[model samples]
Structure formats: C-alpha cells, structure tokens
Target: MGLNGSIPPDIGNLSFLVSLDLSWNRLHGGLPKDICIHNKLPRVKELQLSFNDLEGEIPLGLGECQQLEILDLLYNNFGGHVPREIGNITRLTKLDLHWNNLSGTIPKEIGHLSNLEFMDLGSNKLRIHPKRSREQSYTKTQGNLIQSQRENCVLFVFTF
Candidate 1:
C-alpha cells in the first residue's frame, strides 16, 4: 500500500506488533505524536522504516519500547533533535539513524544504553559543541563509558 501523509495515529494500536516494516514508502510529516500512548510493544524486537520519505523529529515515546533491539531509521528525511529518551532503551543493540537530516547534539543520555552494540549516527548534522569545560568533560566521560562498554563486549560496531 502507498501510505502517504502523516503516519497513522492508530499505529500504536498494534500492541502485539513484534516487527513493523514501513520502509520504502511515501510516508511524510512528523511521526505520530501519540505513537506510543497507551501502547507498549514489549515484545517488539525490530522496527525498520528505512528508505522512506518520513520527516520531522523522532517521537520521544519510542524510548518506551523496552524490548526494542534493532531500530533502523536510515535513508529518511527526518530532522530535529535525537530524543534523549532513546537512551532509556537499555535493550537496544542496533540503532541506525544514518542518512537523515537530523541535527543537534547527540544526547549524553545515550551513554546509559549499556547494551548498545551497533550504532550508526553518521551522515547526520549532529553537532557536539560543549559550551563549558564541565560539559565537555561530561561528554568525554560518556564517550569513555561507551568505549568501556564496547571493550567488554566481543563484538561492537559504532559509527558517528
């Protein structure tokens, strides 16, 4: 089907949805604001929406998917800040947001994702300009934490 305009508000109704494949469509506009309201995909393992016309900031509610392991939003028109809440998904292993129009700093909270194995935040306008020395220190600390986490893992692929 040729899904156009904004993503359907009722998409959250698929509570049992384990994997959602909405890639390569003409979907546009910001992701539904209520995309995760009253809906929780606890068993969802993968969410692929790559190569689409999707635009706007990723919904913060996506962080609610506690079981999400793979999140692919590559090759889209999405822009705006990458939500700090994404760091809440501790189970995330593969997160691909590359090839988008997203901007703003990568969230420091991302360091909290202890289980992230493969991350691709490249090809986006992610500017990390720490205004203060303390901020820079904190960001560096987070970077070290990520490095430590990767060191402990046998396999990890990260691209910024």
Candidate 2:
C-alpha cells in the first residue's frame, strides 16, 4: 500500500510486527514522537525506513525496543544527532544510518552496545572521538584481534 504524508502515531499498534518496511516511499513529515509507545512490537526484529522523504530527528523512544536487532534508516532527510539512548537497546546487532543529513558527535554510549556487530555510520557528518590515546592504541591492537575472531566465528556459522 502507498503511504503518504506523516507516519501515523498509531503505528505502534502493530504489536506483533516483526519487521516494518517503508523504504523508498514518499512519506513526508516528522516521525511520531511516540513511535514506539506502549512498548509495542516487542518482537519486532527489523525496521527499514530508508530512502524516504521523512525528516526530523529519529525518535529517541526507539531505544525501548528491546528485541530490535536491525534498524536501517539510510538515505533519508533525517537531521539532528542520533540519540544516545539508542545504546540502551542491548539486543541491536545491525544499525545502518548512512547517507543522511545527520550531524554531531556520535554518542560514546554506542561503544556500550556489546552485541552490535555491523554498524554503518559512513557518509554522515558525525564526529567520532577516538578513545584516549593509550586506550585507543590498546583497543586497536587487542580489539582487532577479538573482532577478527568473532567475524571468523560468524562466517563459520553462516557457511555451515
């Protein structure tokens, strides 16, 4: 179905929604402030809203989606910095916010997402501060090793 204008605030009513794909549409206006109100979509795993005409800041309440695993909002007209509360979603594994007009420092809280494996923050005007000199160097060397091992394990599982 073709959805134009603003996304309805009642969208959160889809309690059983596992994935919501509204990409490449003409949907305009700001996202509802309480898009994820009532803790709806407790089982939602993926939400794709890329390449739309939507504007304004991303709803911070999205952090309440505990079961959210993938959130793609690329190529939109979204502005403002990404909400730091996004780190509260511990189950997030993949987050893509590339090619948008978003600006400002990427929240340090993002580092707390231990389960985040695929993060594409490219092409945005976000400033990412490196960890302290010593910590940065240590994580670079040690973290790379750990990340490589994890990637290998993921690849192995996928291949099998």
Candidate 3:
C-alpha cells in the first residue's frame, strides 16, 4: 500500500504481528510507545522502519518486544540515546541505527548482547563519551573501536 500520513496509534492493536516492515514510505511522526499494548508484539522478531521520516527517540517500551532480532531504523530522523532498555533484547543480532540524529553515548549495556554481530550506528551526530567505551569488550579488544564519523559527527561503533 502506497499510503501517506502517519501511522495510527491503533497499529498496536495488531496482536499477532511478527514482522512489521514499513520502510521507504512517507510515514511521519514517532512510533506508538505502547505499540505492543495488551502484551502484544511479543512474537515480533524483525521491525523494519527505515528510510522514512520517523523522528523522536526509540520508544522505551520497545524493550517489551523481547524477541526482536533485527531492528532496522536507518536513514531516518530518530534522536535521543539508543534506549538502554533495548539492551534487554538479548536476541538481537543486527541493530541498525545509521544515518539518524541520535545523540548521547550508546548504552554500555549493549556489550551484554553477546549475540550481536552486526551493528551500525554510523553517520549520526552522537557523542563518543569515554565512559561508553570503558566497560565495553569491543573497546577492550585489540583495536575494534571503529569510528566512521560523518562531516563533524562523531559516530562511535563498539561491535563484539
């Protein structure tokens, strides 16, 4: 559907939704914090909402989707720290938050995600606070502190 306009909050009503891919659309506005209201979306493994105009922080309630594996929110306008609560999703393998306006240090809790292999937080205006790298294993490793920063943006990556 070549739909226009923002996503309806009632989208949370899709209790059985598994993979909600709404990429490359004209969808604006932020995601519903209670998108998984009524304990729904627990079964969701992949949520693809990239290349749109999605602004605002990644919802804190997204942590409720414990089974989320691939969260693609690239090339958008999402801001704020990558929510620390997201670290609770241990099953995530590919967490792509590239090309956005996200700021603040990526949560240290991300190192706890042992299963994470591919993560891209590149091309953002985020800060690379020393604290976020201090406890992370990737930074401790030989030399895995990859910084593919954009024009004046310092995008730090800690992959393990």
Top candidate on lDDT is 3
* lDDT of model 1 at position 59: 89
Least well predicted 10-residue stretch by lDDT in candidate 2: 151-160
Q: Which stretches of candidate 3 lie over 4 Å from their true place?
A: 132-135, 140-160
Candidate 2, after superposition: displacement of residue 110 in Å?
0.9
For residues 70-154, could you state the per-residue lDDT of candidate 2 as single tens digits? 8888888889998988888888887888787788866766656667777766676766445533321112233222121234112
Candidate 1's C-alpha runs over 4 A off are 1-6, 129-149, 152-160
Candidate 2 C-alpha error for residue 32, in Å: 1.4
Q: Between 1 and 2, whose lDDT is larger?
A: 1
- Candidate 3 clash figure, as a count: 0
Order the candidates by lDDT, highest first. 3, 1, 2
lDDT of 3 by residue, 1-160 (tens): 5556787887777777889899988888998878754576878989999889989888888877788898899999998888887788889877899888888876777766656767778777654446554445344323545532123223245432
Over 4 Å off, model 2: 130-160
How do these models rank on TM-score, best leading? 3, 2, 1
Candidate 1 clashes between residue pairs 3 or more apart in a chain or in different chains: none
lDDT of 3: 0.74
Note the clash tally of each candidate: 0, 0, 0
Q: Is candidate 2 or candidate 3 better by lDDT?
A: 3
Q: Say which candidate scores most in TM-score.
A: 3
- What TM-score would each prediction reach against the true structure? 0.78, 0.79, 0.82
